[model samples]
Target: MKTLKIFSLAAVSVLLSTVIIAQSKTETFKVSGNCGMCKTKIEKAAKEAGAKEASWNAESKELTVTYKSSSTNAAKIQEKNSSSRV
Candidate 1:
């Protein structure tokens, strides 16, 4: 009986951890830009909008964004960047 209880607890812990992991997501998107200033603006705006992490590469024109799904979404981050003209 004790071993069965331990197994059940372990299974519950794994399920909870999976749910927590699913709540945060990282996504990449292409953003239009020309210089270093653009990269700075893009990344900063994303974070200000509740992104946990943001990075923009000028040459590649790709922005990597990480945020909590419960708090924000990828579309919101993109919108923020575009509105800022980043």
Candidate 2:
């Protein structure tokens, strides 16, 4: 009975961790910019806003940012880029 209880507790812990991970997601946004220097500034701000990764496609004006949803979101990420030294 003790071993069964331990196993059940372990399973519950695993399930909770999985739920937490599933709730965290990456989001993207479109940001306007002109040059390479502007791109650097915008990307930097995204990192400061908790984005684990950030990339800008100048041709499309789309910024692809990967951040944990628990830490950041699409609207907030755009705000960061908009306030950069561009």
Candidate 3:
């Protein structure tokens, strides 16, 4: 019973750590653009900047991105957009 409790606690700790890590590493920000073409360009730029997932909304002009913090950050993604002239 004690061993089972220890195992369950360990599992919960790992799960919580994963959630925290994922949330802390991901970020959302705005990228300037105007249409479907803009969405395509922005998302492509984000991906090129090392994001694991890049989604842009034309209506809101918001980009939601997920990336490894060790590899990339929000600034890098936005910089890609600005540099690409997209």
Candidate 3 lDDT over 1-86, as tens digits, reads 99999999999999988776665366778888888888888899999999999999887888999898767889989999999972
TM-score-wise, the better of 1 and 2 is 1
Q: How high is the lDDT of residue 21 in model 1?
A: 65
Off by over 4 Å in 3: 1-24
Give model 2's TM-score versus the native structure: 0.70
| CA RMSD of all predictions | 3.8, 3.6, 4.4
Model 1 TM-score, all chains together = 0.73
Model 3 CA lDDT for position 73: 85
| lDDT string, candidate 1, 1-86, tens digits | 99999999999999998789668899999988888888888889999888999999888999999999878999999888878772
Candidate 2 runs further than 4 Å off: 1-14, 21-24
Q: What does candidate 3 score in Cα RMSD to the true structure?
A: 4.4
Leading candidate by TM-score: 1
What are the lDDT figures for the candidates, one per model? 0.89, 0.81, 0.86
Between prediction 2 and prediction 3, the one with superior lDDT is: 3
